[model samples]
Target: MKNYDVIIIGTGAANIVADAAIADHKSVAIIERGKFGGTCLNRGCIPTKILVTAANRIREIREAAHLGIHVESVHADWAAVSRRMWHKVNENDSIRTYYEQFKNVTVYAGTASFVDKKTVRITDANNHTEEITGTAIIIATGGRTHVPSVAGLQESGYITSETFFGAAYPPEPYKSLIIIGGGPIGCEFAHVFNAFGTHVTLVQHNIRLLPKEDESVSAYMLQQFEDYRIQVHLNQDTLSVRTENGEKILTCSDRTNGKK
Candidate 1:
């Protein structure tokens, strides 16, 4: 049994915090299930926000005509942008490389599960497992995308922030998009895709876009979405989703009118 002074499960910012603050005499074994730098670095905010930046740039150039700038032929090279952004901060190549130089830090690339209070079992992709015993263990595993249970929603095909930003990057342009939620993430996607010339429709279960925020903000944001011709549906309880003839359809019940 290999023993360590401290064991951290997950490679996110929380693990970084635990790593940096440990006593100088202590050794650390960080167990990473996937990327070394966690979701914000590899999937969550960083990559998605880069796409947002590109979207913002595209929007600016498109609106440049109104300012008499006369910019011509503005286009988004998503494939190139993804390659540059991901490769620049890739965990194996860049961000996580810094820890490899530290003699006190050892990183394990596999999923870690608590065998008991003081021991963790790490299993790699090949199913080989190693048990590490530690005096102290910290769990910092991150989150996953929430997929609501609407009938046929999963089978019909839907893209959330995780899949669109984290997993799959469609090489070709997406002609139309129907965003399920109307919170910040959904709103951001509406803006980004609409700017990139995709028809965007936002379905909000709440009465307003940002239901948690002040009504004024929701109203203003709703106006902004409409300005870009982004369709907004409020208080729409999406009952189910289905595909027919290559078109995905949302069967929804209108909260305002009780019609489906």
Candidate 2:
């Protein structure tokens, strides 16, 4: 059994707590199921922003006509963008290396489950198990994409934010994309792909994009989406997704009138 002054379940916000514990002359143990940097660093905000930056640049160049600067052609090199994103976000090994350098810090690459109030069992990829107890346990495990239960969604296959930036990331921009949900992630992806020359259709269960935000903001975003030539479906409830004749198709019903 290994013991520590502090045990952190994840490497996301827990990193800050670990540093604090280390500064206080405490031994720290970090157990991570996936990548060391957790969601925002590994698969979420940071990587998504990298792609968004490229998309924004392409949109800017294409829309430069308003400033009397006519750019004849705007091209997005998806391979280069993807390479840069992967390069910047591939810091898992480095994070582990840095943590390992600290004699008082131990990094475990695995999932952790509680054995008792202060003790936890860690199971690694190879099914190896270890027991560790800590005076202080910090559970900073982050969030994941919530995939709704819809017919044929799983069998037909789809990518969430996790897989979208991971090994399963497509080599080239998709020719077309159907994005469900109208919150930040879906809308951002829609803009990015549409700017990169992918036909984008965004379906929102709510009547407006960014439904939680102010109505004016939603209205403005909807207008901007229209200006970008991105298809927007409001108040839509996705029924199912299927692939037929080598084409992916999504079936949705109008939420307001319940018409398919």
Give Cα-based local distance difference scores for all models: 0.81, 0.91
> Per-residue lDDT of 174-220 in model 2, one digit per residue for the tens?
99999989999999999989988899999899989999999999999
Which ranges of candidate 2 are over 4 A from the true structure?
none
Please give the distance, in angstroms, between residue 250's alpha carbon in candidate 1 and its true position after superposition: 1.4
Per-model TM against the reference = 0.90, 0.98
Cand. 2 TM to true fold? 0.98
| Residue pairs with clashing backbones, model 1 | none
Candidate with the greatest lDDT versus the true structure: 2
Q: Tell me how far the alpha carbon of residue 139 in candidate 1 is from the true structure, in angstroms, after superposition.
A: 1.5
Please report, as a residue range, the 10-residue window in candidate 1 with the lowest summed lDDT.
16-25
List model 1 lDDT by residue over 110-134, tens digit each: 9888889999999999999999999
**Best candidate, TM-score-wise?**
2
How displaced is residue 128 in candidate 1, in Å? 1.6
